[model samples]
Target chain A: MAIAEQLQEFCGERRRDLVRFANLQLRDEALAEDVVQETLLAALQGSDAFSGRASVKTWLYSILKHKIVDTLRSRRREVPLSGMSNADDEDEGFETLFDRRGFWATEHKPHRWADPEDSLEQQQFWQVFELCLDRLPARTARVFMMRELLGLETAEICQELAMAMTNCWVILHRARMGLRLCLEETWFTR
Target chain B: MMNCKEATQLMSQELDRPLTWRERLALRLHNLMCSGCHQYRQQMAFLRRALRSRSGGD
Candidate 1:
């Protein structure tokens, strides 16, 4: 099969997931669609770069990740930092998980999370995972996605987001804690 | 003694950068005595692994 035909077929099959992944990161449906469109067009033009070592889906996602990050960077430039800073303020909800003395609150103590590795194989588990990711505050989710999903270094993330290193760490911590709690409540315990 | 809050912060930081030896010692000591924080660290690690595998997989 020609690389173009292969890519067109692949895109037809995976476009929805690609768009969902972008929307999850961008939190904007129209913007997500635009980015995915850009990604597909890039993939078509650069089909030679599609080394067969990685699966087509993974290759597509790598392209989409860059487009998403580019969109985010340009969006950041347009918006005033002051307006976004308030949204990024540490959420007090995280503090509720810990007591005044800084111990885990009784109701929020971490559970053993029986056989978490096994859950990764389940389709339902991914649904719960996406829901948990969706529940995170927008900026928090973006920061977490940039670090964890896109595999950006903390230093790079700080520079890209125009945030202090310490602030980046705090946001990542909040994301991990929040996702942990959400998965426990929604999947592991259930 | 490092409390669970501080210990968990170090655990999360461990993912992003190398922890100082002192920070590592405090987290290790806290994890030794505190099962909750210990499990919290494990869950964080699990989250990272799961996410990486998911992205890298078809």
Candidate 2:
């Protein structure tokens, strides 16, 4: 099949995942749809650049990442402070995970997740992972995805989000703790 | 002694940047006696691997 036809088919298959990824980063449903649309259009126009080395999904994701970053940079000046304030501003919710003396609370203690590596091969595990990820606060999810999925550095994330380095670390720590607990509860223990 | 809270923070920070020797030493000491924290660190590492596997061709 020709590249154009292949990419059209790819668009139908991967569009939902791409939009979810963009929505996580942008936190705007409409903007996420627009970016994904633009990504597919760009891929179609530059179909010659569709090197066979990368899978179609991966290639589309790379394109989507650029589009999301561009949208973010363009909107940086006008982003309402309120939008960025709620996610990392307070530590009160996370504080309950520890006790007065800083020990893990009995109910919140981390248990051994047996054979976690095996879950990678299971489709159900990814479904649970997505659900847990969706439960995170929007800004927190964005920061975690930017760092872990997009492979951005701490300094870069801080700069992009206009957040303090310490604040960035706090958000990441919260994300990791929240995700670990969610996975343990919903997947590992079950 | 570093408590579980501090130790887990160090483990998460380790992913973003190199811990200072003092911080590393403190975490190392805490993990030795803290099974919960040790498990937490391992889970965080596992999470990272899982995410990278999904974001292939990056």
Candidate 3:
């Protein structure tokens, strides 16, 4: 196949992953959709020069991430966070994430939990997982999703968010805690 | 104060279960001395399991 044809085919297969990555970065499905479209176009246009230096997916992810960061930085312009919780965050069970109780409380174990990593392969499991994720504070939500859902490294997310190591760690912590609290209330009770 | 950020993060992992080596050590160290963190971890564990089931559930 021609290089463009081959690159086109390769990207088609991984389009969902690309779109998902962009979605997490941009947070708006429409904007993510636009980013994917632009990324695919760039990949297709540049295909003739593609020397296979890296796998197509990696290259595509690189393009998508840069495009996303550039777009976000230009558009955001330091607007203070809107404090908008998800309209669908109807699952109020995770509200404790916002509460300030015994957070440092060095007392009891609360309880012990079994592993759900085994069940994580299923789409439904991920759906609710994504739902809870959508509830996190936006920056925290973005950093956490990029690392956990999309498998970006801590350093990469830190760079993308322009956060310090400690700041990134703290965001990940809060994101995890919020998701944990949310997931426990929504998923574990059964 | 561990702050909501740190507490939330540590508590979140504990909820997810089978704590990492780092978390286990932290919990062990804190729980050994501080009764509060111990109970906190315990409650977090319970809350986590309960939430997990609900997640895979309807």
| Highest-scoring model, DockQ | 1
lDDT of each: 0.85, 0.84, 0.58
For model 3 chain A, give the 10-residue run with minimal summed lDDT. Answer: A104-113
Please, what are the lDDT tens digits per residue for candidate 2 over residues B1-58?
A: 9888888889999999999999989898889898989888899999999998776554
Candidate 3 yields a Cα-based lDDT of 0.58
Counted clashes in each candidate structure = 0, 0, 38
Give the interface RMSD of candidate 2.
1.9
- Name the TM-score of candidate 3: 0.56
TM-score of chain A of each: 0.86, 0.82, 0.63
Tens-place lDDT per residue, model 1, B1-58, is 8888898899999999999999888899999999899888889999999888766545
- Candidate 1 segments whose C-alpha is farther than 4 A from its true place: A1-9, A85-90
lDDT of 2 by residue, A1-190 (tens): 6777767875786678778777767878999899999999999888788887887777877887788878877887787444665655656377888999999999888889988999998989989998898888767887898898887899998988878999899889989988987898899893
Q: What is the TM-score of chain A in candidate 3?
A: 0.63
Q: Sorted on TM-score, highest at the top, how do the candidates line up?
A: 1, 2, 3
Q: Give candidate 2 regions above 4 Å deviation.
A: A1-6, A84-87
